[model samples]
Target: MKSKLSWFSVPYVIWMAIVVVVPILIMAVYSVTTAEGALTGENFVGMGDYAGVFLRSFRLAIIATLVCLLIGYPVSYWMAKEGLRFQRVAMALIMLPMWMNFLLRTYSWMSILENHGLLNQFFQKVGIIGLYNSLTGQSIEYFTMLRTPGAVVLGMVYNYLPFMILPIYSVILKLDVSLLEAAQDLGASGAQVFRKVILPLSLPGVLSGVTMVFVPSVSTFAISRLLGGGTQMMLGDLIEQQFLGGAYNPHLGAAISMVMMVIVVVCMAVMNHFGEGEEQAVML
Candidate 1:
């Protein structure tokens, strides 16, 4: 018998079209269409903004993604493989920061990282460094910390680490113990078992976590605004500038957003391809 729910799908499809497809269509059109009253080739500008975004935001996103992987993988693996009660505690702790408002979290980092801030104070108390007489003292260069690229990466990591952790944890938790035992039975060393068995088995999680962390971290504007300031401009900040900072160029903003979307899609595709290859190799 034929399914009778075809009519029920219409409302959901229409909602998706209105919410997702329509905006994307508008953005695609805006990316190609020029601004009114502007000079020739001024509005869309083709791939120029995309190139600029690559040069500006690509490096920061890569760095942030790498840092998240480095930090998140170990935490996820440990929690999944070991620490039962502590795993819950760790997950709770990871998510606790998120419970607070995101802006507040970013601002909190500002206070901690500021030269004369609590971090420096704690360091001074521990005799790691001397107390700063001023916020700009040689020992406490808060201004540098406030508006720097490093801060941008730090903020991104702090904000998006949970995304990396959750996916990897899910994978790690579901990993077959038999595979690890079999590797051990075959005389594989600890490192060998991890490298050959655990790592390969966990590839799906790694891919998911990386994509989740990388895409949003790259596009996030709030962290950069609060932490990086004028010195470190990411694609999101640049797009915001076009929309809100007296530029009022929705056409340009749309073009940039479309480019960002393309980059995210391409990166995800490449990662997925690699992940599939790894999965195939593991299966073989």
Candidate 2:
């Protein structure tokens, strides 16, 4: 009973091999080998020079991912459990921002957060800024909000929050409502039900959200550039420089890309391991 559609994926598989696998292979080869094609460990060693950049990028990304999780879980749970009509609208609203270009969203944040921007102006007009200065006994007119790691994290969170929400929402939607009802029947509190049942069952979504948010946050150049400003650099910025900066070196860029790819693989494996742990928790 072979269906005609059984082989439908062959073209996609071939396209993926050509468009994705081939370039990665070329980059991997270029990374470890010198101009003379002699393999060396120096490329890996070179990673040390940008260690601070890596640390800062990961630190901010971890914070942003956690923040998204903290904010997204409740929202997703609420929305996923809503009436079908409202849920459809809520889903649409959540996806509305994504329909716009990502760069435009980041740029909008820049305008809002900049000094004398909408945020500051609104606070001032509302007298919140004056009250803050009076309470703190400081004569400061405006506080610096833009061009910092916090700003970078904010941009990452804003851009990737949907990624965290959507996966968790879908997972929650598919969850067996009976398990929740059974836990309730056992006299478990709302939080207890979530802890012992809902959360564990939603592990797949949580893992997906973390991967979706963290990977892009760790590797993002635009958010760091437009928000963190020129003063900060993520691995993406560093890699871009290696390739396109005045001192262009394709080999170094390729090496950095390879290292970044390894890190991504490790993070994904760690996330998967957490999903397994959650499965065990559910069984218990």
Candidate 3:
């Protein structure tokens, strides 16, 4: 009966093979096989694309993940403990921006950060300095804010915040209130209870949130292009350029994509290890 019912899944399985597995297989082949007039081992270059991504995208991803964790943890905790009304309001607010186009959100930051923009205007109004400072002159100092590495991080944090919050919120909502009460009853200070009990118990959510934020942020191209300009190219942008830009080198793009996949896989594995440890401790 189970075996017979499995036949119903055959279409879905074929779809997965066609859409997911086939693409991945093609990427893997492309990553190893170089462009040639004919298929040959001469085109196969080993580990170069992976090494380039590690040198470029890895640091940005690490920074973005850390920023998301720092910002998301406290917000998730507050929502979880503050009752359903507040939780609903907060979650709605977090998710509201997602309804707006992501590219529009990225571009909006440019309006505020551009040299003649709101931030500079606000500063000027407050008599901090003129908009045309000696360093920036009359020209918009997009490099200072819009095109900097900081912009990339800011864009990533903005884009991926909801991903981090939702998973962490789930973990926090399910936390055993009795454990918190027990810690308080045992003369644990508020800080001590949080550090020892709340933090440890929330590991699974934290891991899930980190994985969600890190993977997408690392692979996002629109954020980097819109916010960081040409200077702040991430691995995603590089892959995109190879595929869509005049370069038109899908082979190199695939190689870079594979590198990104490996990095995400490794980071998730490390987070999962710690998450499982916390779960086991809770069980014991």
Candidate 4:
């Protein structure tokens, strides 16, 4: 049985070597080489010129992750405490949008957030835009929501919010009911019980959700490109431009990708370190 299992694993190992390990090795080589195939350090050295882009990417990602957590945690907690049928219906509703094509979903937001889009039209009809203009003494016809940093953040939050909710919902749903009952019996107030018991226990899910949302949000190009109208460039967009766009600089692209990967790893490591302490508290 062991030998057969090992034989089965051989195919997976080969696949990883081809698709994962090989690409990483290629990227590493590209990052350290010039267009002429000569060794160079200029690729990494030039990253300093785009410090603002890196900071903007991280800021938007962090904002999106926090927004997802702020919205998802309560929703998850509510779902966990609901009846089975209700939970199923709610989950179905939550996941329904995801069934659509990712690009289509983003395109829909483009229509809604554009200057003359549905949201603006609705607000115009309702006199909100005019009212704001009147109060502020401005002549703006429509709110400039698209092609901005906020639009990119909104896109990230909309797309990745589910990733934040599902893990937290799963974790909160599986928490031991007896723990809540025991805490209540021991004269803990509702808020106290939640703070001392539920919140601490839910840290792992929060960490997982943060990772899921932040990783993609930080590296996303499609959302930034579509919604930002090329105004809000991110690390992923920078890398994509290098490899595929008119920039045509694979070495620099690889260097940017490598640095982004390292930052993500470091962030996750810090989060996991904090999570360890939270887990210890829960255990105690």
Please name the candidate that would achieve the greatest lDDT relative to the true structure.
4
Which candidate's TM-score is highest? 4
lDDT of candidate model 2 versus the reference: 0.89
Off by over 4 Å in 1: 1-11, 37-41, 44-53, 131-143, 277-284
- Model 1 pairs in collision: none
Off by over 4 Å in 2: 1-6, 277-284
Which lDDT tens digits does candidate 3 get at residues 202-231? 887888788888888878788878877877
Count clashing residue pairs in model 1.
0
Model 1: residue 209 alpha-carbon error in angstroms: 0.5
- lDDT at 181, model 1: 96
* Per-residue alpha-carbon lDDT of candidate 4 for residues 105-214, written as tens digits (9 for 90 to 100): 99999999999999999999999999999999998899999999999999999999999999899989988999999999999999999999999899989999999999
Give the per-residue lDDT digits (tens) of candidate 1, residues 1-284: 23558677889999999999999998777766666533344554554645755576888888999999999999899999776788888889999999999999899999988778777667767755544434335654323466788999999999999999999998889887898999999999999999989998889889989999888888878888888876677788888988898767777888788878887999899889889976675455
Q: Write the number of the candidate with greater TM-score, choosing between 1 and 4.
A: 4
Ranking, lDDT, top scorer first: 4, 2, 1, 3
Poorest 10 consecutive residues by lDDT, candidate 2? 1-10
- For residues 54-131, could you state the per-residue lDDT of candidate 2 as single tens digits? 889889999999999999999999998889999999989989999999999999998999889889898889998899
Query: Which stretch of 10 consecutive residues in model 4 shows the poorest summed lDDT?
Result: 275-284
lDDT of 4 at 102: 96
